[model samples]
Target: MSTRTDEVERYEHLWQEPAYPHRWVLWDTAGDVLVFDRETNCLVDFDDESVLPDVLGRMRAAGVPESGDYPGRPCA
Candidate 1:
């Protein structure tokens, strides 16, 4: 019973700066996918899982590698 706004607020704190040259993915408290945008310094939430590949592609084009984990935690 979570709304998108609720999801964003829940995960807001975990959103951190990406490494100098790499973008990242992390999970919210509820275990949803969140992608970091270096330029904007924020996370973008996607409703459609199908858009993941496209988002990753855009990130890669901008020089971000495939990120599958966050520190000691696995990416959701």
Candidate 2:
């Protein structure tokens, strides 16, 4: 597992529920992405970084950074 990687998938079923609950399966592998179905709760491993470009593009288009943390931010 690489420390430079991050993965997140929103639980579809919980996404529509009244409570804002999220079931997250995080990965720290440089070339692995997971796609899990909320209904079945099965793990599907996709050892490819190709899909991340599209995902990052979407996030960039939405005016959000591909990543949230700013570890380099200087303390004020």
Compute each candidate's TM-score over C-alphas: 0.34, 0.27
lDDT by residue for model 1 (16-67), tens: 3354644454423345445665445566666655655555444455554444
> Each candidate: what lDDT?
0.48, 0.34
Model 1 whole-model lDDT (C-alpha atoms): 0.48
Alpha-carbon deviation at 12 in model 2, angstroms: 9.7
Which pairs in model 2 have colliding backbones? none
The prediction achieving the highest lDDT against the true structure is 1
- Candidate 2, residue 10: CA error in Å? 7.5
- Which stretches in model 2 have alpha-carbon errors above 4 Å? 1-47, 66-69, 72-76
Task: Report the Cα RMSD per candidate.
Answer: 9.9, 12.6
Give the alpha carbon lDDT tens digit for every residue of 1-76 in model 2: 5332343232222223333222322222455433332234554344555545444343334443122222122435
Best by TM-score: 1
